[model samples]
Target: MQTVELTVRRTVGRSLVFQTKVLEVDANRDDPTIVVACPEGLDPLEHHFDASIAWTSALGRMEYAVTTRPERRGRGRVWLLTLTGPLTGVQKREYFRADVSIPVVVSWTDGPPAVSASTNGTEPQTHRLAGVVLDLSEGGVLASVSGVPPPVGTQVQSVLRIDDDEIVHAATVVRHVSLAGGTGVALAFADPSLHGDRLRQVAFEAERKRRRGD
Candidate 1:
């Protein structure tokens, strides 16, 4: 009964096709076929067109090709897609990355434990690094901060605002570089399945808006 968020795309020849989300579907079983409830107005013309579905699992990112079955099921908008190949593991770099500048706050997880500041032991004090996200992807982000970044393997938590939504992610420092007046650090999301979809959506929208010159 577990549900998974899926990004489904359909393509024809070399040109890119429509991209949509599998709104309501649980793909936990090992069955060869899966039932997906897609959003309205997503009917493809070809019954057997080639498609690909990508989702994040506990193992990692995975994707596989599928073909749509002409037959429909369920009461509402649903489509039956049959697996055409085995699932393939995807690398973090394969995720779509967007170049953007967003404000971020990085909290060092390995820093000193929070201690009470007041005599009554009510107020706690902790240190945080303020940074700007230079670029973003579903897998990770590159940020520039005022202070020296932690070691490459350091663990940190980041809070950033994407449009009107504020997102917090637990991440690890994958790469660090010293800038002219600041430090640049790359952070990889520890639990991508929790917020990967939201990041992907934001990146995609940003790319679209850029193309439209908005």
Candidate 2:
């Protein structure tokens, strides 16, 4: 079996999955094995094991078979795990990675996302502002706009503005608000990281192309 290096494409919910190139078909040999090494703070599918991870050499792609596992007893969150199977003939490798990067607008009243006495940006930048999703590489998160925004139950919409394009998605507020002052609302993206992921993917592919040119 031939092995190929695969870059980490995307991640979500503490799971990172990259793909390797499928070997060209010449003859049959032992079933190929894959060794997955995720970055810090991520875990591989434990229960499914090989069933949740598989690839096709003849087809030159991979696919994830998954199911949603309800989070907690209250349905506060969810775990979508894929059951890997034999990848016999995979194609149309669009968005090969399952994770998404969404666009968002963040706002603050008491101060910038991060609190500071001045606006010189000397203070740490508040990437995850209430109602704003600054970065998605970390675990998915919620922003509390006002007074911790809404907890348990709140209605929200994610209006993302990217370049000249805009997309909207519905989201539910899931958090625990408090009486403390200065809170921002987090707008959940049904398709979180949609725009962000696309941009990153395009950049990555472009860089690959450039390096190839070089």
Indicate which candidate wins on lDDT. Answer: 1
Model 2 per-residue lDDT tens digits across residues 50-108: 22433323333455543322222232222233333444435632222222234464422
The pairs that clash in candidate 1 are none
TM-score, cand. 2: 0.31
Q: What lDDT does each candidate get?
A: 0.67, 0.37
For every candidate structure, what is the RMSD over all alpha carbons to the true structure, in angstroms? Answer: 5.6, 17.7
The 10-residue segment with the lowest total lDDT in model 2 = 68-77
lDDT for 90 in candidate 2 is: 59
RMSD of 1: 5.6
Candidate 2 runs further than 4 Å off: 1-28, 33-131, 135-141, 144-148, 176-214
lDDT tens digits, residue span 55-78, model 1 = 545455577788765444565556
Q: Can you give the TM-score per candidate against the true fold?
A: 0.61, 0.31
Q: lDDT of candidate 1 vs native?
A: 0.67
Which ten residues in a row are the worst by lDDT in model 1?
Answer: 10-19
